[model samples]
Target chain A: MPQTASRPMKVSYQDLFWIFFKAGMAFGGGLGILAVLEEELVTRFKVVSREDFLTYYGISRIVPSGSMTALAVAFGYRLGGFWGTIIALTAMVVPAFAITVLLTMFYQVLKNTNLLPWLEVSVLPAALALILAAAIKLGKDVFRPSAGFLLAAGAFAAVSFFKWNPALVLLAGGLLGIILFRSSQGEAK
Target chain B: MSLLSFILLIFTFNLLTFGNGPAMIPMLQADLVDHAQVLSIEQLLYAFAIARVTPGQANVYVASIGYFLFGLSGAFLATLAIQLPGYIMLPFMRTYERMRSNAWVGRFTRGLTVASVGLIFAATFSIGIKTLGEPVTWIVFIVTLLTIVLLKWNQMLGLLLASLLGILLKLLL
Candidate 1:
C-alpha cells in the first residue's frame, strides 16, 4: 500500500464542504461522479493513489448501503476523523437531495399534463441504457475469467429466471465465495 | 393505511432496498398492492414509468403517488421514509470503515459484489420483458442496446433517441 509520508493535512470544514459540493455538482450517477472525485482528490490532492481509490470504491459497493454515500463517509473519516465524516457526507448528499426534492416537486405539479407521459416514454430507453452501461462497467471489473463470471451468471439466472429472493441469493453467493477462495493459511484468496 | 403505517412502510422499504432507488420498485409494488392497498397495478406501473423518465431515484415516485392518493401529509411521510434510512445510517458509516481491513469482510464483500451484479442483471431482464413487449418495442430495445454497446453514446442521448423512435412508431405505424 502506498502511503504519503507527510501527515494528513488539516482539512477545514469549508474545504470539506467545497470538496463534496463539487462532487455533488459533477454527479451524473453511477461511476461518473467517482471519476471526477478521483481526479480531484486522488490525482490533485494526492490523498490516495488511483489503485487505492478504486479498491475502496469496489469494496464500498459490497457493504450494506449506497456506495457513494459510503465512500463519502470513508473519505471523510480518513481525512478528518468524525467531523470529517460528517462534513464529507453532508457535502456530498445535501446538494443532490435538494435538487431531487425540487425536481420531484416540479414533477408532481406537471405529472398529469398531456406532455409528461410523452416525455416519459421518450426517456425510458435512456434509463435502460444507463443501467446497461453501469452493468457492463461493473462486469469489466468483477467478471474475471475465473469462476467469478460463473458466479455472476448463476446469480443472474437465479434472479431473472427463477425470481428467487435476492437476499437469499446474496447470502448463498457470499458463503460460496468463502468456501471457494479460502486459502490454506485460512486467509481469503 | 394510516399515516404512521405508511411512513413505517416506506422507511422499511428503503432500509431493505440496498442497491439504489430503482431496486425499491418490486418491493414497493408488493407492499402497496398486497399490503397497503395504496395503489392499483395500473397506478404502480405509471409510477414506475415516471420514475425511470425522471432524473432521480425511482423511490421518489412514491412521493408523488402518495401525494396524489392521500394528500400533502402522505407526500411528506413518503419522502421522509424514503430518505430516512440513508440519512440515519450516515453517521455510523464511520464505524463501518474500521472493519474494512478485515479479511473475512473482504471476502464477504467480494461475494456480495457478485450477488449485486446478479441482482442488477435480473432487474434488467424483468424490466425489459415488461416494458418491451411489442415487436416494435423489441426493435427499439435492440437498437438502444446496440447504440450503447457499439457507438459508446451517452446513455441519456440513447434514451432520448429510442423514446422518440418509440413515439414515432406509435404515431405512424
Candidate 2:
C-alpha cells in the first residue's frame, strides 16, 4: 500500500509508472483518456472522490497544456514527488508514441489503396460519437440545475456559432464561475 | 530540409494550436500543401483521415504523414518535435498545484472548461454537418448516436458497427 500524505496520497513509483502506462495504452488522446483515469484510478482506488477528480479535470483543461499529460503529471507528483511526475508522464506518452509510429509505417505502405479511404470515412462518425460520449460523461457533474449547464451551453454557442476563440471563451467562463460559485468558506461541497 | 528546421517548425506549430493533434491539420496543410514538394493535398487529407481513425495523439498521424513524405527519418524528426514540448513541461506541472485554491485561477479554469466544451461542441457540429450532409450519412450518425448514448454500447464496438454499415452502404448502394 502507498503511504498516506496530508493531501494527496503517497504512491509507489512502480504503481505510478504502470498506472499511467496502462492508461495511455488503453485511452487514446489526452482528454478522453483523462476521464477514464479519473474513473478507474482515482475513484475506484479511493485516492480521490468523484468531485475531486472533476475539480482536477477542470483544472487540467484550464491550464495551457495537454489535459491527459497534465493530469498524469499532477497525479504522479501528488503521489510520489518529482520523480513520480517524470515516470508518470513518460509512461503515459511512450506506449501511444510507439503504437503511433508503427501505425504510421503501415499506413505509408498502403497509401495507394482504396481500402484506407473507405476505412477513414466509415470511422469518422464513430470517432465523433466517442468524443461526444466522453464529453457527456465528463460534463455530468456540471449537468445539474445550476449555472454550470448554462455556462457550458453559452460557451458552446459562442464557439460553435460565433466562431469565438476557445481561450477567450474559457476566460469568460472562469470569470463567471468565480463570481457565481465563490464562497468565503472555500469549499466546493 | 534540415532536421533542425523541420523539428523547429513542428514544435512551433504544436505550441500555437489549441486542440490536440487534429488542430494541427490546417497548419500542416498550409506547410505541406503549397510549399513542401513532398505531399499532395489529397495525400494530406488521406493522412488526416487515417490519423483520426487511429487511436492516440493526432500528432502521431501527422508524423505518419511526414514519414510518407520523407521516409523514416522525417517521421522521427516530426514526432520528436511535436512531443518535445509536452515531455519537457511535464516535470514542472507540480508547481502549479499550489495554486489549486487560488480564486483567480479557479475562476480562470472554470471559464476555460466552459470554453473548451463550446469548442468541442462546435467541432462536433462542423464535422456532423459536413459528414452527415447526405440522408444516408445522417441516418448512420443518428443511429450510431442512439446506440452509443441510449443503448450504452462500447465505443469501439459502436465504431466498428458504423464502419461496417458505411462500407456496406458503399458497396451495395
Candidate 3:
C-alpha cells in the first residue's frame, strides 16, 4: 500500500516538465527510464517517495505496453490529469528527440571528414554489447532454471531460425502461457 | 516510401514492443532492413551509434531515418508515431484498473515477457554476426559489455569511452 495510490500528490505542469526534462538531459541511465526517474524524482529531488515510485513502476510493468513510457503516463495520471500526461511525456521525449536530431545534423557535417566512418562502424560492437546486456538482463527476469528456459529457447528459434513473425511468436507464447502456466500451482509461478 | 506507410510502420513496432528500446531493435531491424527496404543494416547501425551518444531511451532512432528519407517533417512525424502507442494506451490505463490483476492477463503477460526476451537474444545474435569483426570493435565490445552489463554503469559512459577508443585506435595500432 503505497502512499501515492491513496493520497493524491499535486505536481504543477511546470514542475513536471522541468523535472522530467532535466531528468532526460541528466542521462541518469544505469537501467531503464523508470529507474532514472526514480533517481531524479525520488532520490534526488524528494519529489516522490521511493515506495510510490516502485508502486507505479510495478503497475506500469504489468500494463499491456510494459514500456517505460507507460510509467511516465502512470505518473502523469497520478500527478495531474490528461494534460499532465502530455506534458510529462513531452518532457521525457524532447531531449532525446532534440539530441538525436542535432547529432544526425552534425553527422552530415562529419560526413565530409574522416571521423564519421570510425564513429559509425566502431560503435556498433559497443552498441551490440549494450543490446546483448539488455537481452541477458531481461532473459534472467522472464525465465526460470528449467521450464521457462524451453519457452525462451523456442521463441528464439522461431524468430531467428524459422523466420516466423515476432508478433505471431508472441501471440503463440501468450496462448501457451494460458494453457500451460495456470494459477493451479498455488504458489507464485 | 509513403509517409502513411512509414507512420504505420512506426505505429506497428510501438504496438508490439513489450520492453525498452533495446528489446525493440530486432523488430525494427527486420522491417527497416529486410522487409521494407528503408535502410541497410550498416546505415541503421550508424543511426544506432549516434543514438547511443544521446541521453534517455532513444526509442526508435527514427529521426535520422525520417530525416534521411523525408527531411524534417518526416523526422517529426516519425517521432510522433513512435510515441503514439504510449499516449494511446494511457487513457485506457487511467480509466480501467481491473485489467491490472486479471489472472488471464497475468498469464498473457508472462508469455509475452518471455518471448520478448527471446526476441532480444535473437537480435543480439543477428547484429553480432554483422558487426564485431574489427579489433577496435572487439575492444569496445568487451569493455562495454563489462561496464554496462557487469558493473551496471550507465550506457552513456560506455558509448563516450567507445568514441574516444575509436579515435585512439585509429591513431594507434
On lDDT, the candidate that comes out on top is 3
Off by over 4 Å in 3: A1-84, A99-116, A183-189, B1-78, B91-97, B151-155
| TM-score for chain A, candidates 1 onward in order | 0.56, 0.72, 0.51
- Candidate 2's residue-wise lDDT over A13-124, tens digit each? 8877777776665423554465346545654566765544555555555555555655766677667767877787677667656665676566657656654446435665
Q: Evaluate candidate 1 by giving its C-alpha RMSD to the native, one decimal.
A: 6.5
Q: Which scores higher on TM-score, 1 or 2?
A: 2
Give the poorly placed runs of model 2, Cα more than 4 Å off: A1-109, A116-123, A183-189, B19-46, B68-70, B87-96, B102-127, B130-173
lDDT of 3 by residue, B9-95 (tens): 766665666534555668778887898887777666766765665666556477777776677887789877766566545654543
Cα lDDT over the full model 3: 0.63
Clashing pairs in 1: A126-B159
Give me the TM-scores of chain B across the candidates: 0.66, 0.71, 0.51
Q: Quote the positional error of residue B58 for candidate 1 in Å.
A: 2.2
Task: Give TM per candidate.
Answer: 0.61, 0.73, 0.61
Cα DockQ of the candidate 1 complex: 0.28
Clashing pairs in 3: none
Please report the candidate that would top TM-score against the real structure: 2
Task: Give model 3's DockQ, 2 decimals.
Answer: 0.36
| Model 3 / residue B109 / CA error / Å | 2.1
Chain A TM-score (model 3): 0.51
Give the 10-residue window scoring lowest on summed lDDT in candidate 2 chain A: A1-10
**lDDT by residue for model 3 over A63-179, one digit each (tens)?**
445355676677776676678778877887788888777767776575444444565445556666765665564465445765457777898899899999666786786677676
